[model samples]
Target: MAPSIRLSPAARSLFDEPLAIAVQGLGPRQQVTLRTSLRDETGELFQASARYQAGDDGRLDLARCPALPGGSFSGLEPMGLLWALQPQKPFWRLVKRDVQSPFLLQLEVFEGHGERPGRLLAQAQHERAFLRDGVRRVPVREGRIRATLFLPPGEDTFPGIIDIHGFGGGLLEARASLLANHGFATLALAYYQFEDLPQKPKELHLEYFEEAVNYMLQHPQVKGPGVGLLGFSKGAEVSLAMAAFLKNIMAVASLNAPVAATCIPFSYKDKIIPAATSYEHKAKTTSSKFLDYSDVLDDPFQAPGNQSLIPLEKAEAQFLFIVGQDDHVVKSEYYATEVCKLMQAQGKGNFQILSYPGTGHCIDPPFFPLYPIGSHPVFHKRAVLGGELRAYSKAQVHAWSQVQAFFKKYL
Candidate 1:
């Protein structure tokens, strides 16, 4: 019989769930290469492979067998094929533009561990989904707000939350869709770079975001006297500002964001917060040829730059700051530490910081590939997004839960 790959429980599962992989009908003690590949909406291919040996019983269980050295990874990571995937195109990130469709994952078994696979022995495919059955994808276009609202399968109104993606924004619904499946009414809000929105706005206005917040509070399906805010990078910075200046923000989960306004100024009625820092001068070229943006922003605690700091002390909401210690895109640990210090000094302990060592920027859901490096989507320049593969993957998983729990508690 030909060696066959078996994916247990279900071939179709949510992206966050784990699966068991095993090979049957292989020769005893046979060496093989296991490879996995998938393409994104833009046709960018991401792939991963590992060397392995079959057991004496003519079978190989990924959970039991350790992957050999000199492949994408080495060790007994059953989900490594999914987590260790790297893009063939340099600096391209894997983001699901359409949550309605799953990423079709192709898996193959090769006869030997050569630089190139000796021969394809077996193959299989799996579907990694973002949205669960019964989840509703609702497009929201109410009064100057462009967004997508995700509703879990039920007639009940749930705790409401807003999800914001970072710079180079279009409407991103993947994270919001997945969060709704877990029982929250999640809204993926777009600030710019979409239908009718400006390509480059000189300043981002908080009044615009406040419109989104008010929409969530007024949503019939969104149970709220207040709503929760979840954001990453520039999005997180915006979330921080909303929590500080806006009402009806019950909680905030910020991922690798700055405490000071960055790149662009922020304005509210009668007030304007000037830009704090930029990538100029500080965005240095690394030895590896990739740009390291870790020091691009000016010091937020010092003269002039300190003026741009978000007055987070004024926020009444509970806060969760998720910091990636090894992030090369920003000084996440430093920013988070200073925020905590400032909060404590103000006699406010409404915040908690979770620092993940060896984790980098671009933290997403579990089982997604390691985005240790990428170019700025807007800037279109190469960047060294620091993180160990295993550590980054683990941090993504843990931080996701922490965000959910924090929201569930306060919202």
Candidate 2:
């Protein structure tokens, strides 16, 4: 027989009052039972019992007794469950029933402070762009590309949109899919598989995206004349650089993206360009080295260095800069200000800039669960405000509408 485990006084206080639990671990293929008792400041409030079964593989199976006050303890869903777990908070506990191998067990005292029913209003919104059909894949350059082309469902030809995903993440994300649902012929290009890790930015190539754009223009569903470019984070920077250097791009929208250059070295024609920039800019200030990526590689279009390497002044496409005020990830306002300054200096007035307050880096459409609010893991010193995923604000929705209108007028 193994020893039983109990909850600490501090841990019990988190459950709204005081709670006690006794857990025993059975050997593999055996089962152990648990009894949970709860009390308020006054006295006993409720009592419950649960059963735990030990599988042959040493995994403990937890089942709640139906007679318990909370009914059952079903686990959380996959994607939405991220908000349910507390990051960097000691909100969970583990109890062991065995001494040697110590059969492990985890318990969460649910006082209902997390994202569960009766908490926040988080819903998923569904909208489709192509009135007639769903997404289809097209073969291009010996490889297949997944794309969603949306027309007005009439005989009219509409402007096209090519959406690029950010670093490491995949194309199946809500951002690209939602844009396609909104009547844009969106091509969510998967630079890397979600299951497969991506190489560092320095190893990326610009020719692949150029090839993607060319393929989109050749598609029967896409409007042949030109197409708009939309990207977030690293993808946004790529879109901006492509618009600057590529002749076919008609418009670009960059969202909360870093303008730093990459580290890969490549030759555009015969000239070698550096990979990324070396500048160290605070949230609102830019150093002279900010655009200098020439030291690393000759191809400035690769990553960090692409900021100053691509000549936006020579770009023919209209641009839109969308940023969140509370975006500590990339310092949205700083990029917006710098880009606007450069555009103005080049006598380019065909660009628009919009910002939203109380919003974090990923301004997902309304209904998605918001990120957990706190300092970012990458930039631990900086504050990150995470909460229920925010949908496009009325103002943001209006801005998106304007973006569509702008592309329609230009592209």
Candidate 3:
């Protein structure tokens, strides 16, 4: 038989899983160049290639063979091509898409690693599924909340969720879009920095969120006497407050969120929750580009006019707090601990926390690189967001499943 390429599961896979590659019908020790390419959100193609030699049996299986030199990755790691692929520049990263779309991994084989005249050997492609098929996204412009609703395909009512983003300040559709693919009707809602919303985090009102809840509840495809809330960072606090003060919020999943109201003052009809006061630690930044926030994490209750603690005693929603122990952004693990203590003291039994020791602040969907530090998008200051690569990746998969199961039971 002529040389050909084959995939273990055959041309389809989940984004979280790996695909096995094999080349067959080559002469023993013959050099073969393997290449793969995937496009990003902006339509830029990110490519990676490697050279390998067929074994004594006239075949090379990625499962049994190692990557050889002369391509993008010069290491001996198996599956190195999947993670080590680079953009045109060293500083640029592979693009990650959060929309409901399948990423195509186009693969090709060449006789050798030739710059211009390499003879083609074999070709194949695999479809990696992330978002589920038939998921529909509708732009939300109703009321004060500017958002987008991702409704899974089908006429049957699905559990509804309102997804809120952090201090970065725009309507992020990724998380909500992915959730919709997992069988939930999700709304990625924005409080600021897009369209007519607030330019910054100021004068936040719970009523705007209430309007969002109403919108989700009124959707014909949403089955809800109540809905779920999913939020990150600053948005996590909003989710907490909504679950505490608003009616019909049955569940909430908060990722790297603070137990105390922090960053911005939160106001309801006649009351205001003071934000926790923060101060930068100048001494810790001498060795690294990211500033350490260890000093500002001092007990918020000790701060003057500190009224940021949400009234958890009033919340009826079931809660799942996902925190990273090494998160340097807002001391998520510490805040999660404090919140758990408060809930225990108040005799609340519907709350639980899943803390990953080595993860970071941005526990996004799986397969994204571990961003150790970056300039805060809104604040424009370099700061640490801690995580070891493998640990953070594991946290993402676990948390994604946990969110679905939690909402399935409570929403």
Instruction: Give the alpha-carbon lDDT of every model.
Output: 0.88, 0.48, 0.78
lDDT of 2 by residue, 1-411 (tens): 543343433121211111233233334544333333322223322222233344565333232211122322223211111112221222111111111121112332222222342222111111111122343333233244443333334444546787776544444434444454455666656665533435344444566667778877876767768789888766787787777667689888877765543434333444444545433333231142112111222323334435345457778888888787666456556767776776798788878888766555664433232343433323333333322232323334455566667677777
| Residue-level lDDT tens digits of model 3 in 181-291 | 788999999888899888875768999999999999999999979999999888998999998888999999999887777778888899888776655543266275557
TM-score of each: 0.96, 0.55, 0.83
Ranked by TM-score, top first: 1, 3, 2
Q: What shift in Å separates residue 257 of candidate 2 from its native position after superposition?
A: 2.1
- Residues 116-167, candidate 1, lDDT per residue (tens digit)? 8888899999998999999999998888899999999989889999999889
- Output the number of the lDDT-best candidate: 1
Q: Against the hidden true structure, what lDDT does model 1 obtain? A: 0.88
User: After aligning candidate 1 to the native by TM-score, how far in Å is the CA of 375 from where it should be?
Assistant: 1.8
The 10 consecutive residues of candidate 1 with the worst lDDT sum are: 371-380
The candidate that achieves the highest TM-score relative to the unseen native structure? 1
Off by over 4 Å in 3: 1-39, 42-131, 281-283, 301-305
Error of 2 at 294 (Å): 23
- Show model 2 residue runs off by greater than 4 Å: 1-156, 193-201, 262-267, 270-309, 372-396
The candidate, 2 or 3, that scores higher on lDDT is 3
